[model samples]
Target: MSKMIFVNLPVTDLGASTRFYEALGATRNPHFSNENAACMMLTDTIGVMILTHDYYRNFTQRPIADAKATSQMLLAVTVGERAEVDRVLEAASAKGGRADPNPAQDHGSMFSRSVEDPDGHVWEIFWMDPAAVPGDSSTVDA
Candidate 1:
């Protein structure tokens, strides 16, 4: 079987979070969804599980960091072209997300931008010209 990834996030408003993800082109999967959690499918292999704060707490003992005020992990997604990255940021912004929370990155071959969801979870959208990568590629790590 192929590997799949499901990034679980704690959300204050399940409805708003679900809608925000829809704006980014994800569809809710009813099979894994309920009143306290919504499973949004970004792709066949990538999914996002947005759970209510109460429900999320059931899985973790640590305090939930206020994503708006504190730094946590950053999530990223790659698109096929540079224009797609811009389109995603615009969509996210239109759906109450903060566009470009971080500085944009343009390395000729790789272009990236960031957006923060209403809960302050940062999502980086990027595109890269695969051919521009060196044969060794390890030298380009950043």
Candidate 2:
């Protein structure tokens, strides 16, 4: 069997978090959702489980940190093109997300920007030209 990934985030408001993810093109997966958690489908193999703070606490003994005050992690997403990267950043801002917590990055073959969801979880939206990969002479296009 293939591997699947599920990123779990603690949210203060499940409803708001659900709307936030929906704005970013994620769909709701009813098969794995309930009152305390919303399963957001990012792709066939990837999902984000936005759990209420109380619900999330059940899984960890440590107290949940305030994401608004400190960053716990940065989740990255890739798009087809640089324009699409910019597009998602803009879409994020329009949908009540915070954009550009850090300056944009350009590494010749790759470009990336960061956006934070309503709950302050950072998501890196990026585009990379695999053909232009650096240091891998065998695969990189001339």
Candidate 3:
């Protein structure tokens, strides 16, 4: 079986976060959604679970940082083409999210754009060309 990636993030409100992610082209997985949390399926292999602060705190004893003022993690998702990056960012902004105020990277072979969810979770939508990617390294410096 292929490995699936799941991202767990803390949100102040579940419904608001769901709407924010939905606007970014993610569909909610009813199987994992509830009042305390919602599973946002970004793709077949990539999924994000946005949980309320109270619910997420149950998983750990450490304090969870308020993402709006402090960044906990940055979520990066790839696309097949650079256009998809803009498409996703636009959709997100339309739903109250904000686009990162910086130009996308153009490493000759790859391109990317970024957005911040309502809760301040950062997601980078990018496109990569296999031919341009380094053979020995999984990622480029750019």
lDDT of each: 0.92, 0.87, 0.83
Which residue runs does candidate 1 get wrong by more than 4 Å? 134-142
Which scores better on lDDT, 1 or 2? 1
Runs off by more than 4 Å, candidate 3: 101-103, 134-142
Ranking by TM-score: 1, 2, 3
Q: Which candidate is the best by lDDT?
A: 1
The deviation in Å at residue 94 for candidate 1 is: 0.7
Residue 92 lDDT in model 1?
Answer: 80
**Model 1 Cα lDDT, one tens digit per residue, 1-142:** 7699999999999988988898877899999999999999999999999999999999999999999999879999888899999998999889878999899999999999998988999999999887888697446666
Q: How do the residues 1-142 of candidate 3 rate in per-residue lDDT, one tens digit apiece?
A: 8799989998987887898899877899999899999999999888999999999999999998766677666678877776787888898888878897446787867888888887888788888877766675565676
Which runs in model 2 stand beyond 4 Å of their true positions? 134-142
Model 3, position 6: C-alpha lDDT score:
85
Best by TM-score: 1
Instruction: Tell me how far candidate 2 lies from the true structure as C-alpha RMSD in angstroms.
Output: 3.6
TM-score of each: 0.91, 0.88, 0.85
